[model samples]
Target: MKKIIPYIFLISVVSCQYFEKEVPSEQELMEKQMKEINWKEVDEYPSVADCEAISDETLRKQCFFEFLASTIQQKLSVDTLSVLYPELDTIEVRVTINPDASMQFEPQFPKDTVAYDTIKIDSILRVKLVDFPKVNPAIKRGIPVKTQFVLPVIIKTEK
Candidate 1:
């Protein structure tokens, strides 16, 4: 019994390293999780009440943007933009929707654009875009997130 006890203790001591696992540090675990996440992709896009019924992800995003662009076009059509700048056909608007449900709109002009009065166009957009219904912010990993998107608004006027 005494001879067997020493052999058992020797075997247990030599085999203990094989049974142990290297624990990853917190930083390593965080880096691995970040690598698994895609920064450019979102689980859900920011949406208005009208777009909530869409089931498909791609279609929901499309509907949201289209509804916003159409609403913008309609609202701006009645304003003095076309009359003030008849040559301006379309403007790209960058809309930022915050997680807190606040919003902002900024007109995007081309680098070569020097003809239109930017201040007037920006003021017009600000005034006309205030009436949009409350928007549900985008979702990432089930948490509400801010989203920014650009929509092209065409100017149409009938003579």
Candidate 2:
């Protein structure tokens, strides 16, 4: 009876699954990892030389905008149009900064200001932008990312 009891116990223990947990498949594991990641926001922002000094996120963002504006303003010659088109007050420049820091842009001017030649404006902006310094692009999960900005350049009227 004792030998039979020991044999029964051994059989019961061996038959019972010690580790019942199912091992996840590679595809399942990968899908789970992907779901864990947050894809909406970048971990780091695109930064210029001047903006790098700022530590605060909001302030750094502001500095970045200001830096780009100042750089573009320096190269852009608004005076050329002032004499010909005094009515034009602003130009909205749409810029896309690629992951590699290269830029592409389109300028939008008011339709009412027909006297202002758009080709001339585009040429001037394109040339000036070519000289713009390469900036560090935004990053997400250690990968460089592209970003876009719309900047309104106010035409300074001589007072």
Candidate 3:
């Protein structure tokens, strides 16, 4: 019985190792791709004022300066998070923007003067793994893993 138990344990350990998923090389590939992405293209936008005009009054007043931050400015100033893991066939990214309410705008400020407001905007990016043919084969075959990246985005408007 002792011998049989030892054999069973040995077999189980070997089988577990055999069944374990291997790490994919997608991390290196993703990092290379991320480094090559055109940051300017991602940051470029038509107008900040137009973007701000669509927000509610509370957001409008609170995020007044943030609403004035152009995509270019944001791209130039904000940091980005990027990661790659195995098992994800496709990455679905969702962006959400939340404005802070503590900020107040002073109407007396000059048009060109950049005013600092207490309002802060939270930008969240949600990433999910999905089944798709375009995903890396190695990643698809490995253990399923998903990753999310969040960034604080300041929306800007035109003068």
Candidate 4:
């Protein structure tokens, strides 16, 4: 009975720690994980079929950007942009790629820009930039994520 009493007391003291310490709630655990994740950058950039097999991250990104730039240049060349707006040699476009492998584009114009040129340029872009090849969406932590970025496209590749 004496030995049993000591064992019981030792067990009671040790068990007290279990009650004092917290097992984190689901929300708390989730919040901690979210904080630990890198939100500023994606694990993989969006890619086309041409860039899919590239193993090096930097090269893969370069290939994708180059492909997009050349495609844009080719498409825009068919438009009468030079005849309509000869002075406008370059434009910045905001491109958004969704997780579902869809895309959207909008021209980024300066605040002081004239409405007439903006309207014309926008229409030209909409008409010219269509029927692009499918793009695999960016990935973050093994999950597809939406990404948006501004690209400076040279309106006149000859220049």
Per-residue alpha-carbon lDDT of model 1 for 27-81, expressed as tens digits? 9999999999998878888988888998998898899888888888999999999
Best by lDDT: 1
CA deviation > 4 Å runs, candidate 1:
1-13
The global C-alpha lDDT for each of the candidates, from Candidate 1 onward, is 0.90, 0.80, 0.32, 0.88
lDDT of 4 by residue, 112-158 (tens): 98744787788888888889889999999899999999888987735
Cα RMSD to the true fold for all candidates? 2.3, 3.9, 21.6, 3.0
Candidate 3 local lDDT, 1-159, one digit each (tens):
988999999999889977888775998889988888654332212223433455464454344334333332343233322212122222122222212111111112234633322111112121111121121111112322232122233323222
- The residue ranges of model 3 lying beyond 4 angstroms of the native Cα positions read 25-27, 31-44, 55-159
Q: Candidate 3 has which clashing residue pairs, if any?
A: 48-156, 48-157, 49-157, 49-158, 67-155, 67-156, 67-157, 68-156, 68-157, 69-156
Order of all candidates by lDDT, from best down to worst? Answer: 1, 4, 2, 3
TM-score pick, better of 1 and 3: 1
Per-model TM against the reference: 0.87, 0.73, 0.23, 0.84
lDDT of 1: 0.90
**Model 1, poorest ten-residue lDDT window?**
149-158
TM-score of model 4 (CA atoms): 0.84
Candidate 2 shows a clash count of: 0
* Candidate whose TM-score is highest: 1
